[model samples]
Target: YNVTHVPYNGLAPALTGIRDGSVQACMLPYTALVKNLNGKDLRVLAVQSKARLPWLPDVPTTGQQGYPEMDGNDSFVNIAAPKGTPEAVIAKLEGALQKTMQDAGVRKKLEELEVQTMFMGSRETQKWLEDDVRKFSTIIRDAGLSTK
Candidate 1:
């Protein structure tokens, strides 16, 4: 099948196209586009997340769109410091992070933004990264996809 690839440098242009009906559809990160979905005469064909986001519970997931067990919302973020960062600095950073996570205002703001925070300390983050790399490598190999 032939397809058109109209690449926009960023989300702003793509969103403009969507809003102006210049494009029929495109796959976008849920949170980035959720604001547009509200109060617009738009229908979400499907969400990529395993489960619908709390803010958009009415939206069906890609799995529910008949692609069983599909995961379009697979993404992660990580925190890292320079190789020789002092332990004192690391401890300070961790303390700040923990305090932010515990703050009701911060938590409420994040939730309102529809972002699910997965806060992990350095060691746990390292382990999670290793596990994810292994898992993703296996998936890529099994799917016959490669960077090269």
Candidate 2:
């Protein structure tokens, strides 16, 4: 199928376009669509994950919907510091972030917002970041997209 891609500056405007009927559909993080889902303004066709999201249990995963290739595109939220930041400082921040993610209040708020929290140590996060870069770069190259 030939798909025409219309670029939006950000998720907010893209979602607004969908709400106003200017855009027919969009692919966005579940957290960004939580309010619209609660308000019944949008319907989630499928999630691009191997398994269904805990918060949106009723929504089927892309794999479950017969699109296995769409899976493994999970969006993640990460906190980063400068490239030359000290290892000790990075470890301290990672520890604090892990603690925050484990906190009842923080967990509850994230759950309410439909954000899946995956707290990883600095080493794991660095590896994941490298893997994501390589994966996305390959995807872009395969699709003939220009980084410029």
Candidate 3:
């Protein structure tokens, strides 16, 4: 399929464009489209997660639709410090962050927001990112997408 990219300032405008028929489709977060999941006008073809989303259990995944290479595209948030930050401070922050994630209120809020929180320490996060870059680098290169 020859698809054209439709740029929008943000999710709201993208949703508007789709609603107005200015664009046929968009890649929107579950939060952005949750209100319309049961509406007749909006149709979700697939979710990019490896398995079905708990919130959208009826929606198929890209992998389930025979696009397994597009699986596990979970968005993440990262906290970072400058290069010379002390390891002791970093450890303290990591410990605090992990504790925060474990809090029932925090976990409940995250679940309500439809986010699957997977906490990783600094070393684990770094390793995951490096491995992702190597894996997607080849995919991007193969798809003729620029890495620059």
Which candidate has the highest TM-score of all? Answer: 2
In order, what is each prediction's RMSD in angstroms?
A: 3.8, 2.0, 2.3
* Cα displacement (Å) at residue 40, model 3: 6.8
Worst 10 residues of 2 by lDDT: 1-10
State how far residue 55 of model 3 sits from its true place (Å): 1.2
Compared with the true structure, what per-residue lDDT tens digits does model 3 show for residues 1-148? 7877667898889989999999998888776776776666598989988889887889899899998987876667889888989999999999999999999999999998778887999999899789888879988788777655
Ranking by TM-score: 2, 3, 1
Cα TM-score per model:
0.66, 0.86, 0.83
Give lDDT tens digits, candidate 2, residues 1-148.
5756678889989999989998788899877887788449999888888789887788899899886766878888878899999999998998888888999999898877778777888788789789878887987898888776
Assess the local accuracy of residue 76 in candidate 1 as a C-alpha lDDT between 0 and 100. Answer: 55
Judged by lDDT against the true structure, how good is candidate 1? Answer: 0.74
Work out candidate 2's RMSD over C-alphas.
2.0
Number of colliding residue pairs in each model: 0, 0, 0
What's model 1's lDDT at 69?
Answer: 42
**Where does candidate 1 have its weakest 10-residue lDDT segment?**
68-77
lDDT scores in order: 0.74, 0.83, 0.85
How does candidate 3 score on lDDT? 0.85
